[model samples]
Target chain A: MIELRDVHKAFGSNRVLRGVNLTIPGGTSMVIIGGSGTGKSVALKSILGLVKPDSGTILLDGEDVAKAERDAFLARFGMLFQGGALFDSLTVWQNVAFRLLRGSLKRPIEEARAIAVEKLRRVGLKPEVADLFPAELSGGMQKRVGLARAIAAEPEIIFFDEPTTGLDPIMAGVINELIREIVTEMGATAMTITHDMSSVRAIADHVAMLHDGVIQWTGPVADMDASGDPYLDQFIHGRAEGPIEAVR
Target chain B: MIALAPLAAVGRSTLAMLGTIGSVALYAAITLGHILRPPFYIREFFSALLTIGYFSLPVVGLTTLFTGGALALQIFSGGARFNAESVVPQIVAIGIVRELGPVLTGLMVAGRVSAAIAAEIATMKVTEQLDALVTLSTNPIKYLTVPRVLAATIALPFLAAVGDIIGIMGGYLVGVTRLDFNAAVYLRNTVDFLETADVVSGLVKAAVFGFIVALMGCYHGMNSGRGAQGVGRATTNAVVSSSILILASNYLLTELFF
Candidate 1:
């Protein structure tokens, strides 16, 4: 289980996260939804200790993320960045096998390459795509490569950041299904942050809505439509006006 | 009141400059600190050496060569006023060994390597590749900055040596073919008049210039703002700052050595 208790983060006078508290049970998918710059990613990154919360505790399976050993702690988590974050200089397979070929998880080159190829196939990329660079791939393919690299090490926890942001609706749907299938099969805990309503419906088992630097609503995905919170209603329905300010 | 406004503007600019300088110094110190620590990335280091040192050979060599040749021509013409054109070989040797080789090599590499490093790193930051690196259990500075900085530091002296030698050869060609100096006499004058200290000081200047170039690149790149404009600004700043620093430090190093 991952728990964020009364998390607070501020950049200068701009209070990005005032007091955010949330929790996710083991092996479940929790998607946080919010508008632009409302601190959704900040809240998620806070859990990973990537953006440190000014004051609060982020506990992953009982221990504080800040207190745990960094490399060992990080090895348990995989992240798919919004932009795909694929290393442009390296080939697709090298990017996928990066973790296996270095640091504590070092493996023989051939073994690592084989695993990378398998992961690429797992993500629906062809074996031939392995030799190509990130620039050579399309946006959707790059996202798939990023996804492959994220799960390459078969980590215990996975974080997805705006995974469907830039893709066409069709490609986004494809990615959503793949994410759902992979997360379910891996049984790894997942915490995703996206504003894609379709993605919420497709990939989330539970949902949290962030607004005004706090979780305005969070519950099982089933209850989200009828949650009756004006803020959540305004957000989920794509309405521009509610308790939340539109332009802040 | 108008006078006060101008004064306030000057104060703001001064403070901003100082702040930037302080941050760069801190960054350099952090890079130095990381370089001394363990868990070094050997592959990244060698790759940096190849890119910064080996690949830079042609640009450095060619720039120094042309400058040396031009200097020979100018010096020969100027010395002709006194009928002392025989000073060509000695002046070319000293000038190439003492100043032009290191400074020109530094400036050329600053334009090439600094911009490339900044663009590559700023692009990494823009795409969140650096953040991904962090998540992958790698320190971006240790993985990126230290190797490049170390390679530049180690590589520049060798580059400067090569540039100095090639630059002398360029002057030799010019002196023999264009200046009508006896080839044997020119070679003898160059060999007899040159001192080891002059060559060593220039190489030292090159080393310092290399450190400045790579540091400016890493510093601006890492601190770059978001988007294409941000990365573009970082690249420009890297080249500009590295060039300025190389020239300024070259003077200081020369003063100390001389």
Candidate 2:
């Protein structure tokens, strides 16, 4: 289980996260929905210890992960960055099997490459694609490669930052299905941040709406349409006319 | 009032630059501290050697060769003014081994390797790859910086030594062919003038300059700000700082040893 209690973050006078609280139980997928600059990324980064919050307790399985031995704490989780930030210098297989080829978890080069291929296949990528560099791949291919890398170690917890952002609608749906299948099949606890409603519906077991630096509303997918909070409503429908101000 | 305005501008700019330098120093210290802690990545060491040393040979070699040739010409012409042209080979060998070989090679590698490491890491920072590494139970410093530092430290001195040999050969080519000096005499003077301390001192400078280059690259890259402009600035800062530090430290080392 992941638990965040009364988190606060501020950069000078600009407060990004203000007294936020959240919890995601084990064996479930929780998605946070928020517009750009609404602190969803900051909240996620705080959990990953990328952006240290001014004050907060990020607990993982009852241990405060924010202050935990970072490498050991991080060993249990995998992440898919928004941009599919594969190492430009490495081949696709190398990127996927990066963790397995180094440090305490290293395998033989051939073995690591084979496992990378298997993981690539799991993400619907061909074995031939393994030798290609990230620059040679299309956006959708890169996303799939990113997915393959994220699950390469079969981490217990996974974070997906805008998993389906730049893909075409068809590719996006495919990715959503892939994420859903992976999360369910692995029985891993997952947290995804996205503004894509279709993705939230496809992948989230629970949806939390972040607005004004706090969670405005949160519930099951069924309760989403009737969230009743105008901010949540405004975000879901992506309506121009609402309580939320539309930036020019 | 006008004089004071210029002075105030200079003062403010100096303070800002100092502040920037201080932050880089602080970041480098923290990174070094982290390196001494656990979770060292040995694989990255080989990778950095491949990146900083193996990949940098051609450029360093060429720079040293040309610099040696140029130095020979200038020294020969100056020596001729006092009927001292026979000093060419000895002066060239000493000059290259004592100062130019290490300093020029360091500056060249700094220009090539530091910018590359900084730009790559800065791009990783902007693209969230570094964050992904952190999430994967990897200390980015161990995975990234330590390896480069170790590789450069081990590899750069060897490279500098090679540059020293090639640089002397360059002077030999010019001295024997262009300056009408006997080959045997030029070789003897070159050998006679170069002491062990000179070469060792150059190698030591290479080691320090290598650390500075990698440290500056990793520091700026790790602390890079958001977006393209931030990365651009970091790349520029890494190259410029590494070069300046190389030259400055070279002078200090020269003064200390000589």
Candidate 3:
């Protein structure tokens, strides 16, 4: 389980996260939905210690994330970034096998490569694509490669940031299905932040709507529509006007 | 109060500059500290060595060669004004070995390597690859900055030595072909007049310049703002700052050596 308590983060004068408190139960997928620039990414990053919060505590499995041994703490989590964030210099397999190739998870080169190929196949990429660089692949293929890399180490927790943001509807559906299936099969704690309603419907066990630097509504996905919160209704229905202003 | 606005602006500018200097110094100290820690990436180190050293050969060689030939001609003409044209070989040797060779090589590498490093690193940061490295249990400083800085620091002295030899050869070529000078005598004069200390000092300077170049590149790159404009600015700053630092440090090193 991951829990964030009164997390606050600010960049200069812009307070991106203001006293955000949320929790995800073990072995469940929690999808955070928000409009652009509403601190969704910051909130996710805070849990991973990628973005440090000003005056809050993030606990992973009851351990304070900030105080944990960095490598050991990070070893339990895998993240797929919004932009894929694949290393341009590395081939797809090398990117997937990056963790195994070095540090405490070190493995023999051939074994690591073989595992990378397997993970690539698991992500629905051909084994032949392993040798190609990230630039050579299409965006969807790159996202699959990113996904393959994320799960290569079989982490206990996984983060998906805007997983289906740029894909065509079909590809988006495929990725969404893949994410839901992978999370279920691995039984990993999954935290995903995306605005795609389709993705929220497909992958979310619990849905949280972030607005005004705070979670405006959070509950099981089944309760989202009838949550009786105007902000939640306005956001879910994509209304430009309501208590939440559209313009910055 | 309005009349003093210019003075306040100057004060702000000075403070900002001091802040940047402090940040860079702290960054360098941290990088040096990390250099002694474990988890050294040998493959990354060798890759950097090849990039910073071997591939830089042609550019360093060409720059020094042309400079040396030009130095010989200038020195010969200047010596002729004092009826001392025979001093060309001695002057050219000392100048190339002690100063021009390393400075020129450092400047040329600063232009080529520093800009490339900054641009590549800035792009990685923009693309979140550095963050991805962290998520993979890899320290960006350990994997990226340390290897490149170590390679440049270690490789540059050797490059300067090669530049010194090529530079002298350039002078020899110019002397034998262009100026009607005895080939054997020119070689003998250059060899006899050059001191071991001269070459050693230049190599030492090259090492320091290499450190500065790579450090500036990594620093600007890591601190770059977002987008294409940010990357372009970082690249420009890396080259400009490294060049200025190399020239400034060369003067200080010359003073210490001489």
Candidate No. with top DockQ:
3
List, residue by residue over A115-202, the lDDT tens digit for candidate 3. Answer: 9999999889999999999999999999999999999999999999999978999999999999999999999999999999999999
By DockQ thresholds, what CAPRI class is model 1?
medium
What docking tier does model 3 reach? Answer: high
Candidate 1: residue A115 Cα off by (Å): 1.2
Q: Model 2, A1-248: lDDT tens per residue?
A: 99989999998998989989999999999999998889999999999888888987889989988568766677778889899989887899999998888766779999999999999999999999999999999999999999999999889999999999889999999999999999999999999999999999999999998888888888887899987889988899999999888883
Q: Higher-TM-score candidate among 1 and 2?
A: 1
Order of all candidates by TM-score, from best down to worst?
Answer: 3, 1, 2
Error of 3 at B115 (Å): 0.5
Q: Give lDDT tens digits, candidate 2, residues B60-167.
A: 889999888888999999998999888899889989998899999899998999998899999999998898777766778878888888788888898899999999
Q: Candidate 2's C-alpha lDDT?
A: 0.89
- What's the TM for model 2? 0.94
Task: Show model 3 residue runs off by greater than 4 Å.
Answer: none
Alpha-carbon shift of residue A150 in model 3 (angstroms): 0.6
Q: How accurate is candidate 3 locally (lDDT)?
A: 0.93
Residue B78 miss distance in model 3 (angstroms):
1.1
**Segments of candidate 1 deviating more than 4 angstroms:** A246-248
